[model samples]
Target: MSGKKEFGTTADGKQASLYTIRRGTCEADLTDFGASLVAFRTEDRDGRLTDVVLGYDDVRGYEEGDASMGGSVGRNANRIDGASFSLNGKTFCLDRNEGENNLHSGWNRYEKRIWKTEGVSADGTSITFSLYSPDGDQGFPGNLVISVTYSFPEEGALQLLWRAQADQDTVCNPTNHSYFNLNGQGSGTDICGHQVQIFAEQFIPVRKGGIPTGEQAEVEGTPFDFRAPKEIGADIERADEQLQLTGGYDHNYVLAEKQDRMRRAAVVFAPKTGLRMEVITDEPGLQFYTGNFLKKQKGKAGAVYDFRSGFAMETQYFPNAVNLPQFAQPVLRAGGAFESATVYRFSRVLP
Candidate 1:
């Protein structure tokens, strides 16, 4: 099923619409502003419906909120060291938003822009949103055209397809920054009881500013280890230095498989609701953040979101990838296409 509603109007007087897509037992509300996934509802083991992705009640909350709630992040998804990188022997300095480093494309964030509607699918299973980033926009070289498509299939999967093309060599790494709480959006419960398992044996270690230190450290025996299923809070408060530095699990995990191959990256299950979500991506790294910094923010149904209330499984290239030669390069060349897909497959786990 498919439908549309008037979300709100932008400050520039542009109108935004909230589109809804539905499949077998799933429904998603998407907005043109930021091309954000405003809400996603699925059934649990008892066939009880729950909204898994977090967000507010209306467009204004998204416009004035913390910005990243269920939004598409780009032109580079994660951090870039020192807010600059050398591409083709030229230094491209980006706007720094997180300390001395640039996080999620800084001030000119895609999450704050109004994307154009690119039409829905013939079967109403997908809604495509498009945006254009001019050359030198946010200090990045090249004129870039980006399209993010959110699709809902009949088999209980919410898939995201990201495609981009540039006129010059530029950085293009986009990911859906959707924080999820399987129990329910605005459920007022922390994700500590959620069980998480990442299909990675190693992770890129971070420095003081959340920049990768160019080291793919082993996850064995460390709190970073998630090769096996365990409670998200099991090792979160450990005395481990990495945990101490970031305050929780906020680092990038190196996928066990090689890069650019669509594969399973991680799985999260909320025992309370019997909701299971499996993340499949073609990207090489997964930023598993546990909502460590979320403050008391208002949410739907009069719920206030606090720390650990949600978590994000962001799939993309490593943080500061352009500066670290060892990391997978994030450069999209002239006339070349940058294509990637990530799927959040949902299901129920019965007692």
Candidate 2:
């Protein structure tokens, strides 16, 4: 099933609409304001519906609250060291929002803008949002046309698809930043108790300002190891330089090489709810953030969200890939098109 409703008005007086798509009892609420997944409701162990993803009840909270909550981040999803990159021998400078580095393409964020509703599937299981970025927008060179589709393709699964083409060669790495708490958004619980397992054997370590140190360090014998399911709080407070550097798990994990484009990236399970979420993506890296910076802020239905209240599994190309020779570049050639897909498969596991 699918439907649309008025979410609220943007600060700029633009009307923002919310679209809902459902498969069985599981449903996702998406907003045009950022083409974001505002809420995802699925059944728990007791067969009760629960909203797993975190967000506000209105569009204002999304605009004034956490900038990345359930947002579709784009143009370039992660940081660019020195706030600049050279493309085809031409250097392009970007906004330095995070010290001297550019985080999420600086202030001209795609997550804060409203996207055009390309179309909603007749079967009410999919919807697509489109956006146009002119050349020099946010210091990126390209007349880019992008589309993001949110769909419930099957029972217990939500898939996100991204497609884009640029008139000029440019950097294009997009990802969905959705903070998830399987205990329910209003459960007033932290995700520290959730068990997580990432398939990556290596991870990128960062220095100050969260820029990659340009090395893919082994996860073996380190706190970053997650080949087996373990509590998120396990070793999170250990005396480790990497954990202390970002205040938690904020670095990118180098996904193991796979011949298939679509592969399992990570798995997270909430014992309290018996809800298991498996992240599958085609991207080469998975950024596992523990919500280390979340302050005590009011969220949906007056729920107060505090530190470690939620976590994000962002699938994308490696951070600073545009500048690092060792990493795969995110460059999209002129007149060329590319597509990326990620699926969040959910199920109730019996404890």
Return the top candidate by lDDT: 2
- Alpha-carbon error at 278 in model 1, in Å? 0.3
Q: Which stretches of candidate 2 lie over 4 Å from their true place?
A: 256-260
Q: What is the lDDT of every predicted structure here?
A: 0.89, 0.92
TM-score of 2: 0.98
- Report residue 166 deviation for candidate 2 (angstroms): 0.1
Q: Per-residue alpha-carbon lDDT of model 1 for 1-351, expressed as tens digits?
A: 589999878777778889998887789999988899989999989998899988987777787787399999999998998999998899989897888889999887888889999898877789999999999998999999999999975567999999999999999999999999999987789999999999998998888888888999999988888899999999899898788788899999998434557899999999999999999999888999999988998987788899988999999899898898877888899999989999999999998
**Cα lDDT for residue 124, candidate 2:** 89
Model 2, range 1-351, lDDT digits (tens) per residue?
Answer: 589999999889888999999988889999998899999999999999999988999889888875499999989998999999998999999999999999999897999999999999988899999999999999999899999999988988999999999999999999999999999998999999999999988999998888899999999999999999999999999999999989999989998432239999999999999999999999889999999999987889889888988999999888998999788888889999879999999999976
- Tell me which residue pairs clash in candidate 1: none
Error of 2 at 153 (Å): 1.3
What's each prediction's clash count? 0, 0
- Tell me each candidate's TM-score: 0.98, 0.98
Best-fitting candidate, measured by TM-score? 2
